[model samples]
Target chain A: MHEHIQPVALEKAYRLLNHGPTVLVSSHHDGVDNVMAAAWACALDFAPPKLTVVLDKATKTRELIEKSGRFVIQVPTVKLLRLTHEVGTRSLANEPSKLQDTGVELLHLAGDTLPFVAGCSGWLECRLVPEPHNQATYDLFIGEVVAAWADDRVFYDGHWHFETAGREWGSIHHIAGGHFYAIGEQMSARPKRGG
Target chain B: MHEHIQPVALEKAYRLLNHGPTVLVSSHHDGVDNVMAAAWACALDFAPPKLTVVLDKATKTRELIEKSGRFVIQVPTVKLLRLTHEVGTRSLANEPSKLQDTGVELLHLAGDTLPFVAGCSGWLECRLVPEPHNQATYDLFIGEVVAAWADDRVFYDGHWHFETAGREWGSIHHIAGGHFYAIGEQMSARPKRGG
Candidate 1:
């Protein structure tokens, strides 16, 4: 694990994905480590944090997740924009060195066998909540987050510091084609007038 | 219907939500209408665009959706920040005047009774694709987008011009509490290196 990486409380894990950002999905199965970028992931629940990510049937990452029943969803930074696109469009099914060719590096967390993509500001280690119907029909898979971590510099004290952190640390949201939008200015809604 | 609002092709409707933004969900049933803010909405599929939103059982909007089997998911702008938070937190079940008190204005399109938040940048009218087990277990609802529209000034040519449009036109993404980050600078990934 990177020096700056720190564990985020399980209750606060949902905040990591609350703001919709493109994420890198990684999994390890049968000695195979695969990573892919997903734009359709969203936080599903807060307590005992859970999330949903749409994984196309064609991706090797999805296959790994199906076999292992575990995967990691990580928040890719603006700095990883091109890498994210490359991983999302290209495939390990055709290219044997998809991860290496796309400049993806994996970080292992001690005894955990799941592969975590490096350079992400936050990560949620998930256990697949099998839903055969949803998976086969919509390519939608649900995962219950068992552990979570984030870089102290970018996400500490229970919330994102994108406003104070370097721009490179900002999370990116894919628009269409190869275009994306890095999360922008912070705005706070006024507190209740009369509760 | 606002003159600036234009119909978005069904095939291209997914682009409206491709970049994850907190959405305002509105529904109508019997003689009642309701709207609520949701950060858990995500694009589920492309063709015949489908989406998933987690609606807590407590929300009046969810009840309206359950009875009507229809809803509208619209992208709330930075300008609707306070209104979004207010609608999400206040309940029509308790506060009968929630919508009016929160300054939420609605725009109806011809025959449709589903309330569309007036200032939203984009709107997707959906018909519920009922999945009983998922809804009962997860409070997750899936909808197939039957029609869509976007404000031309901000979203035209099938893409968002948030960078060039007024900052307030940008879609807002909730992080936690009432804090949010507006969709930021546009970044394009480098073109594919090779086939």
Candidate 2:
């Protein structure tokens, strides 16, 4: 059921991140893994979809992501608010691994390349685009998205249907102090170009 | 009336952007000025209040912002949807800049250093922190916010009061195709660390 959603076009993958939901950065390397929350990420480019996420130098996820040159970002729903806070606050270094620290279930990709949190609304597999200067100076890393997927029940046909019947998937955007604002009330504005 | 709002502590300023609203990047350089719509920006650091915004190399606003080394990000309200469309569509390259392209009432600081749209609920005045690698490779510009302000009616004492009486100043989050989701209900998640 999790794999039912088809891959999003690399170009359109930026849309999944367009609205700025807080994401859980997941990565694995050499049998070691890490996960952490990051609100400092945004679409860096459109085609060949690229994204920039800040990972502080002192994080276990940063070490794992840098070592493997790949990572996955997942948009968790409000239902995972407790888990989000749990995973975000604790360091993998303290517990030796995220898998042991929390009750969150993880699904490893074929060949055990990287891990993705189960029950996430959206997920993107990305390979690092090396930018050492930004990484060392700002703790920022750029990634070129190679694969993308989302729960079709929540996103499909290039649009998000949080209102779809029997579908209650809504992306979570963390504000401050463990507070989150769930995506709500979709409305469209006509393109002002044809005037 | 958009002039005065108590200064926000730099570290806490990220809270303002943590929710992820599309912002209007307003900048001026050598007497020329421009404003463009941007949904690709996020709070990067806490202390010293740093932010990262993706600016297309082709955008006139990017050129002006790069030259000025200063830009103000204004968080527009839902009431400015038409103005947002107008600003997003019209480029600064052609005659009549976004300031004039849209009928937005401009509010300028006394020093003329920072300017903001009158209807916006929050504003951040940032000084560029040059990261040439990210800029040349990814068109990402990093800025350290020096001063920040917010409309007391909507944001006071670091909490948004959109639920208050008389005025409802909801922030706009851009999804794609000029479509946006007005910021909806606020929900808080307690710290799982202590609880």
Candidate 3:
């Protein structure tokens, strides 16, 4: 499949996460790469567009990310819903190689040599900000977007267009008990006037 | 309004965040309390029901939470949508008290002294699990749910019945520019057969 990488103004980078979709954290080290599904990520700051993600102490993705100093978060499409669950619960620690177990397709975008899940709608390639305290105590990793890209067909001009896409492009919000909530019913609220 | 506080098993607490709704962080210090809206809150654990939230250093709510060692996360209903944006951008640090500016009705649940915003669908009252490193570096706070309660009118048996009698009890998921999405459309996918 073909792809394009757009330069999202650092200030606008927060828009990627403002919607709160469960994402796959992808990392590469020593020519090996892996992706793990994470439902615990949020926009931590604007202007510079920073994000904080929780990488568990036991996950191989965290180890690889620490060694490589870079990781990419891919917003998985609806078609990969089951795959998201597979990656989230399976431990890379248990299996030396997860890519061998989970059959999820992979894609490489932009300057991100790290491989991303093929069915994702957007990708944020991040460089680790090295918050040792947050990482050790809270499993929180802060990153600054080095490069960002999205499937323009779905996300463009700062708005996620889920109407045109099929489940393969629909974002997944995972609830517990193996259930997930697809981004549903769109509505916009104007800012309340003059408090 | 009549309300009930039911105990939710710790393992299932992630359901509170599964839909990704913006929340009001309420805290009290020496009898002075404050509430602020946070669009960036997410689940960090399942078994222990840990949560990760960002509390700006400049905010009074943060100070109170640090001093009091507790805070409550209240998931507001669609009815409270009008007041969501008001608390987020306006800091209690400037105003003498947030309660005055927000005009949001507050109720103190039994067993927990922190105020919870009435009309909200659920409430998670947590004790600060201080990680000084994470706090000093990223302004990220981690809390373990010591007590949790939900308005059963909306949540029961592990799912939100917004379409039923609790129609207006849907949780508010905010995107950007004040545009919010009420938790819509719920689907259940049974876990695939045993490996």
| B45: Cα error in model 1, Å | 0.5
Across residues B110-180, which tens digit of lDDT does each residue of candidate 2 receive?
26855566777888889999878778877888899998888787877787666562324777778788777
Clashing pairs in 1: none
Of the pair 1 and 3, which is ahead by lDDT?
1
Fnat (0 to 1) per candidate: 0.90, 0.82, 0.54
TM-score for candidate 2: 0.93
| Candidate 3 local lDDT, residue B96 | 77
Give a tens-digit lDDT track for model 3, residues A61-159.
Answer: 999999999898878877787778888888777776677788867777754578777767778888899978668866878888877777777778877
Candidate 3 docking quality: incorrect, acceptable, medium or high: medium
The DockQ figures for the candidates are: 0.88, 0.78, 0.58
iRMSD (1 decimal) for each model: 0.7, 1.2, 1.9
Q: Give the per-residue Cα lDDT of candidate 1 at B27.
A: 91
**Number of the top-ranking candidate, with TM-score as the measure:** 1
Question: After TM-score superposition, what is the CA distance of residue B26 in candidate 2 from its true location, in Å?
Answer: 0.1
Q: Tell me the tens digit of each residue's lDDT in model 3 across B1-195.
A: 654657666666778876677898998888787888888888777667888788889888899989988998888877887787778777876777657767877788844568888877788888899988778866888888876777777777876666673546777777777776665555554565793
Judged by DockQ cut-offs, is candidate 2 incorrect, acceptable, medium or high? medium
* DockQ-based class of model 1: high
**Model 3 misses residue A188 by how many Å?**
3.3
